[model samples]
Target: MIKSVWQGKKTFKAQSKFGHDIISDAPTESGGDDNGASPVELMLSGLAGCTGIDVTNIMKERLNDTTKFEITVDDEREDNTSRSVKYVNLIFDIEGEVDLKKLKRAIKLSVDKYCTVAHSLKATIEPKLIYNGNEEEL
Candidate 1:
């Protein structure tokens, strides 16, 4: 298990000997120094990074020679709430001559089953994915 402790000011610092230090703070609107990424942004980014790694690894394992992998996540929030993410859309741009079928299947497996972050977030949010430069749904 992992544990963290925070002290004074808007800044809270976390450290693990095997991991990089983490710093969190309130947004400028909330009287913080705005020194780090907002919590919501970090959450979305975590999901994107996890799925991106899974997709890239799958492609590489298939000997697809994937050259580039980019994932962009956009979140929509409902009004008058605590700014929780209501919807998340992920766009994956993969560069290589990879089999579209395999790419899609890998992404589906990651988002629907393997990605713990995506799975946890899905309970309180709607998640969608776009794959391989296709405008069609995935």
Candidate 2:
């Protein structure tokens, strides 16, 4: 579980069950200090982090990595007052010596089987999430 408490104007301190904590604040223009990401950004970050952990663990356990790795996520969503729906467009920048085929499979498996973030989002909106170079559904 997680909890959030009002920290001040447009800001809150959020903590998860394991004691990890972070500040969620609005943009500076919204009277916030801009010290941390907004709540929406945190959701996206959680999606990326969940997928990243899955891929890393899979690669390591399979002895597939021969160098360092990095991942990045890009999204596409528009502001619409008519509905409470949003979608994601994730683009991953995977750099390392891992096999492309295996890596793609790893991503597929992660999105197909292991990613709770994707599952959670899918509960509300249909998210277009891709891994490696393959587009996947949740």
Q: Each candidate: what lDDT?
A: 0.78, 0.78
Who wins the lDDT comparison?
1
lDDT of 2 by residue, 16-132 (tens): 899999899989897998878987788888888998888878877654554555555666666775433366766667655668898888888888899998788768555576689
Q: In model 2, which range of ten residues has the least summed lDDT?
A: 62-71
TM-score of 2: 0.77
Q: Give the per-residue lDDT digits (tens) of candidate 1, residues 82-124.
A: 8778899999887877888998998998898788899888566
Error of 2 at 120 (Å): 0.5
Q: Which sections of candidate 1 miss by over 4 Å?
A: 122-138
Give Cα distance to truth, residue 84, candidate 2, Å. 5.9
Error of 2 at 29 (Å): 1.4
Off by over 4 Å in 2: 61-66, 82-85, 124-138
On TM-score, the candidate that comes out on top is 2
